[model samples]
Target chain A: MSVGYVSVQWNRHKRIYDACVAGGIVLYLGVFFAAGKALYTGRNAISGEILAMRALATCAFLMLNVILCIGPLARLDRRFLPLLYNRRHLGVATFLVALAHAAIAIGFYHGFGNVNPFVALLTSNTNFTSLSAFPYQTLGLFALLILFLMAATSHDFWLKNLGAPAWKRLHMLVYIAYGLLVMHVALGILQTQRSPWLASLVGVGVVIVATLHLIAGQRERRHDERGSQLSPRAGEEWVDVGAVDDIADQRGSTVTVGAGERIALFRYNGCVSATTNVCAHQGGPLGEGKIIDGCITCPWHGWQYRPADGRSPPPFAEKIHTYRVRVVGRRIQVDPTPLPPGTAVEPARVEEVQSA
Target chain B: MPGLILLGASIYATVGTLFGAGFVLRGVERVDPAALGAPWTFRILILPGVIALWPLMAWRWWCAPRTRGAA
Candidate 1:
């Protein structure tokens, strides 16, 4: 876990995983370019360069869609976690393919046109005011730049330097990039191509991405609702999370306190401790992870924090808000107001029940 | 001037790729040893992209934690 500085440590699995991706890309491009040539033979006046460019563009766009889906897909099903681990490769490959498409497009459309291709790429399209005639090339370029930035910073090294929260916020810009790409394709190629099938495909892609995000949000909302519904054993300030017996060893029972922030009540050894359920790294649910080596480990990235103080161990400093907790008999009571992150607090011990 | 810039960029990429081959062989394998195995031909597939952006990777490599990976 400590080797964060080295090049991606390649193992047999990553080797095979990357090989499959390469093979898939080649197969997709081969089949797509051949199909385009065959389908448009004689009927359309499209050339090889244009056809190849379109094939790569379509392939890259499809990959982007799949890459975006992997996040929500993994959240909905643990089975998809393997795909999530190597997702950065897919993103980098998409950018490379998209770069090829851009290269060919510029060569054919803008090359030898009395102006420098680089300059032409900008000044050639200035009809941004009109929706139909909007400079879609500019949008595509904007999206590509975002993709480039994301690919550049995809490594853990960048993640550690940027800090996970900031890194996550930076990567979230992809949603904006996706929106720009959708408009670029709809206004640019779809206009010239004039196919209902193409428009339907774009519409379907948008719907799928939107639907997956909505469903994931709703699932989290339901979990929050259930956590808030449990009643307190004492005053309004201290909520009864559950009987200490109900909390699994090393894991926590989440409870929503004031302002609806969820708190994870963990039982480690004979004691109980609580922290913000939202992990500092990508907001992962910390209540789900087991304690490893006496520290609560984040399931998403294996980041550890002391349950009592909610602070990560040395060399990696991350903190989460902790709550004051105490046990009354077998029932666990937690104070709603969370201490600032990294504040030390005593853990509540689970009372051993005596024989009748 | 544009042609010269493109030529310079290509040259820079070539050097990065040359350096990246060893980095990928030595250090890259440690970044996520669990996921990747010993370098193979297929791993070279990522070389162009990796080298093209090697400056950032180099910087990250320098900035990353200095601890030796666990056995």
Candidate 2:
């Protein structure tokens, strides 16, 4: 959205969102540290640093769970959309907490070793084969690395440079990171601690995350497979996009052609043109966007493109795959063959030839 | 940087095919023919994570009846 790079395009909403996140972290640590201490009083004495690390670890894990849940929750209900807007913020916080956890663990567990601490971490943790005695620190380290990559590249600059597909692919490592963290906790603590409450909490988090993803994925698959194919196909085929009236003025409708990228057919100014549903910026759904000022504005980032040529207006040279569309009777048919990135084509106008 | 990413993507695409035929049959869109047919790089670049996290993407794709801000 920004023409130039700024550290962060912070707004009142972002400020409030980050504040709540900070407050939540503080509150959770305060409560958990106090409660954990009281509960474990009769057992072997636990040091404050270790307890603090554990608290941060748990918080980061919880925060990640919340972050992952937001995507699915938003899809299930519109109310969760606000959380999605600031998800990257939540991700950065999670990384900080995770980093803190690793720092404390490093200084405590590996700091005293004569062989460089980093070297000792790998050398000391030799039990990689055993399930019960696995080196959970290694798992944690891998998870932290993934988190670091995601957090570091969270900015729009990285997104723009890397391109949407690449950026999304990189960030998708979060799920792998999640899986690793779950193992980090389960094998690391549950194997020895045998704390039913902690086990239950981790179990709950996994169940919630896994269940929501499944439900959401199933819903999406059902929808795409429901009636027709929308995206373009191999060897070029004509697909029914839907009725002309189905698309409102300055609006686009998506129709699945078969198995490929989705195509968006836009109706504007008594004419219709079709383009790839995928937006160049962040792969936002173009079909979901609206035409304003005679340009299609992407819903995700508001990147505007001319309806006639599928090209973003001046100063922004983004282009999308445009399709040839024609109207037959009342039904609209789209040629799924995508033109070059920015090919200009005459729009198929919905003209009325009235007998005078 | 993109070239390096492409190498990584190739590795991912290979693994995706070796272990993802069932996944593709199971409806993994990242490695579909449409995605892989052209340069094959797009599928390679996108399939790694798509195969890794198809559930979330699928949900994101179709969970909503109408996309927000749609006219």
Candidate 3:
């Protein structure tokens, strides 16, 4: 992170990630175009423009599916975290492709009329009563608008200006967009085409996305339940977290205290410290992240904060709430009350507790 | 009706363009200190977002804490 915002702080990994996305898009479009040409010929001939639209549309849809899956996939397994890192790049690319497809489609189908292409596109289709004749283009248009909003605000500037919570809520409109697109496909193309493959593909995608999310949600619920089961130690208000040794060196384990407030207990340098599990940036799960270079690093965007003070290092000004923690025997106990952001709390020494 | 809608959109676009020009040049630095020394290319890239969100940005600019010589 930089003190001042640049367009993007390009790194070797970002470069490689972007290159792979670009190469994949180009390869997919090429294959789609070639396949369309080879299969649809003579009586079943399709125009190159229509073919291009189809290619971009399908590619954008698949990209969005992958984008939606990445979140739960990362939560399910740490190995998928790299995919979650630069997922916004894929999102922006998908929007661009979808925009191109929409532009070509509107220009081809509606531009020939005297009415404005957009107006024609929306107003020409009025047979909404019949499922087959539903105005699917309007659904597609709404979804595109949502995608455009997201893509436009994908930069850090918007995130900072909008505040993380509001920005996150706004971005969650993607689910609505996805739903609209599904209807757009089912009603528009599926009605005309006598193909089970497209229907099966969409069904399978929905199932996989739903299944992964359910599994991840269940796992998170179980984790929270386990943490919640640990009551305040005897009469003391300090909640008993799990064993100090259970948290690996330079790693964190989360515990839920009073009313489901999750706190991450991090062990570093033979001492234990506690901080809020929510990252200051994007609210990433700090508990899932490990401490690197003596700082707790957020898994989502590599935002780092000192484990003791919960403050980002110099020049960058981000902070999270810290909690007073102590090691009682082998178990780490933390005060339920949270100190103000960046408040320094003394780390409890594991050796001292063991010796006592 | 289509013509009226198109005209309204054109007016919105024009207003957005004017607002965006001022925002990228001066209003940005006032609202966000991090945008103070941002590169021209970055500013250009953020213009669409600024235009789309001009009302909010303008409000922020208006309510920005006054630094010495900022007023």
Best by lDDT: 3
Provide a comma-separated list of chain B TM-scores, one per candidate: 0.67, 0.33, 0.86
Docking quality category of candidate 3 according to DockQ thresholds:
medium
DockQ of each: 0.07, 0.02, 0.58
Candidate 2 chain A: worst-modelled 10 consecutive residues by lDDT: A226-235
Candidate 2, DockQ score (0 to 1) = 0.02
Clashing residue pair totals per candidate (backbone < 3 A): 10, 6, 0
Task: Write down the lDDT of every candidate, Cα atoms only.
Answer: 0.77, 0.76, 0.89
What does candidate 2's lDDT look like per residue over A219-302, in tens digits?
Answer: 767767853436435565666768888888889877667666678888888888889988887776688677999998876546
Docking class of 2: incorrect
Model 3: residue A50 alpha-carbon error in angstroms: 0.8
- Angstrom error at residue A175, model 2: 2.3
Which parts of model 2 are misplaced by more than 4 Å? Answer: A37-46, A75-79, A113-115, A226-238, A245-252, A267-272, A291-295, A327-330, A345-356, B1-71
TM-score, candidate 1, is: 0.71
Off by over 4 Å in 3: A233-235, A352-356, B1-7, B68-71
lDDT of 1 by residue, A69-102 (tens): 9888877886776676577788889888888998
| Error in Å for residue A137 of model 2 | 1.0
- Which scores greater on TM-score, model 1 or model 3? 3
